[model samples]
Target: MKNPNGFGSVYKLSGNRKKKWVARKTISWENGKQNRKIVGYFETKNEALKALANFEYIENSKITFKQVYDLWSKKHFENIGHNRATNIKSRYKVHLSVIDNVSICDLKIKDLQKLYDNLNLSSGTANQIKSILKMIFDFAIRNEYIDKNPIDYLEVKKHKSVLERKIFTSEEIAFLWNNINLKLVDTVLIMIYTGLRIEEFLNLKIENINLEERYCIAGSKTEAGINRLVPFNHKIIPLITKRFKEKNTYFITCNNRKISYSTYRRAFIKLMEDLNLKHTIHDCRHTFATLMSNAEANPASIAKIIGHKDYKITEKIYTHKDKNELIKAVDMIN
Candidate 1:
């Protein structure tokens, strides 16, 4: 069988005869410039030769950005964390997967910008997509697939508007306590006083409670959150004593059954609706922080108590001034 010396050769191995065609072309130029390399195998001899021809043709015509990016992503994200890799792949599936067939040369800055802007995702998510796109384009440039990265000029817009969270006032809190089932009131009050996230509160086990030390160790969302010792408020003690007698395995439960997220969510929603309040169960945490701030509690201490990674988050977002506190402060103007 005769094959061109410069072009790739297609051959079947002796032991694996009738196997699919295997083709290999050297990574060298036509003008006597050579490099040591073996390229690939294909389903047929024509397919192998066609790949070689395209390899030569690609010098003049560009490959798709998708083709370049897919290769790039494999190497780029190989060393990243599993959770992070999953997140990046999820974004690619939703946003970048469609444009995989578009040529790199045809992709302009505006084309990418339009794709990003159309998503209308959260600030954090939008920024993640922008960062990933730039990396993909940078990969294309480094691989000689494109001259410059169009993603360099792209800007991800921030959603400037912040959502207003509803927190309960002292009066509203008392009204809620007075209205709900006496048994459920303990769980609600624990969340309000302890500043524990609803899920964290639900996951508390019998061993996690330390009555001798007066601080129950719980919370597992972040490094700061894990095993945080939240001191029990005096009011929730009676409820604890009652539960201790019942000998339930978990801290929060219904008839010895674990209080699932859905069950708690439904109960919270029902309570809010009954009270005609516009607040989620998480607002109990906000209320605790607000009350602490009003009592002149240290911001750093508040952050630590609530399992915040940084105290600045507590100062900036959690420690808000109530209307009564604002009025009292203004009255002190002499």
Candidate 2:
């Protein structure tokens, strides 16, 4: 069978064998040298046609990868949650320059693999790049700009290093609470008491805290976007209530203006240095989960409080349940 464009050919291989399809595009260089390139070879005509159609579509759109990516980024900025949109824009600015000029359909998995290999980037960073590219491709496809995502076939290498899940001991927590200034102390305290992410902590509003109900309704950054109501015991209620008079906006920020992640991270690092603590801000969240598990809180309940989808996520990430509580779990095993 001949291609619709009369630029390629397809043939049946043999009995009990599939058909072979090939696509070729020829062009003359600036120096008048002719070049013929094989765009793709597929086992099925349908697959070949799909690829050809994608190529044709891209060529016809007359849109550069940069143009499409910019459009995607703008739409993404408008659609995604604020924190997520910020992260996507930051990542794209850092790693997407190389492929910005190429057409979307012409971006091969091999090209992406090579770009990833040369970047000297961490697996997590590479994965983020892949994710951003996938998002852009999804946008393109949804808008009928392309037929398939070439990025789907690319794989990111996994880093074997396990993340540190440090949980502050009760004594350490008391030491931190006593030493730090009142302004920043409650931020850490809230994270330890509620297992909320630092981002979530900064985003919390006065309305989320219901003194009458004794629970704080907060949104998590997980895929499901779970909004959990964490019960505030007598201890945490007074701490949050005291701050109610300061501002009606976020609990952590001073001016109600959104603080960047780097700003908070730097502040936490300075705080840690002053205290001579070896733990990260995330450890406060871990400490909350550990303390809860030690208090014999149910795994499912802990997961719910932390906005995790299920107990498995809580267990997988916070592997170090308090030893005494672990013993109780162990006792049940036998």
Model 1 earns a TM-score of: 0.49
What does candidate 2 score on TM?
Answer: 0.53
Score each candidate by Cα lDDT.
Answer: 0.70, 0.67
Report how far off residue 273 is in candidate 1 (Å).
0.5
**When superposed on Cα atoms, how far off is each prediction in RMSD?**
11.5, 12.1
Q: What's the lDDT of the predicted structure labeled candidate 1?
A: 0.70
The alpha-carbon root-mean-square deviation between model 2 and the true structure, to one decimal in Å, is 12.1
- In candidate 1, position 78 carries an lDDT of 84
> Cα lDDT for residue 183, model 2?
51
Q: Per-residue lDDT tens digits of candidate 2, residues 1-334?
A: 4556435443334555454676555433456755554556678877766665554323425667787888778756876787787777677777887777777767767887787666656678777788888888887777556788877887667744456778888787888668655456766776787777877787777768777756667787785335666666445666777777445566665565756776787787887777777888889878877887787766755766666666766545433444344323322210
Which 10-residue window in model 1 sums to the lowest lDDT? 325-334
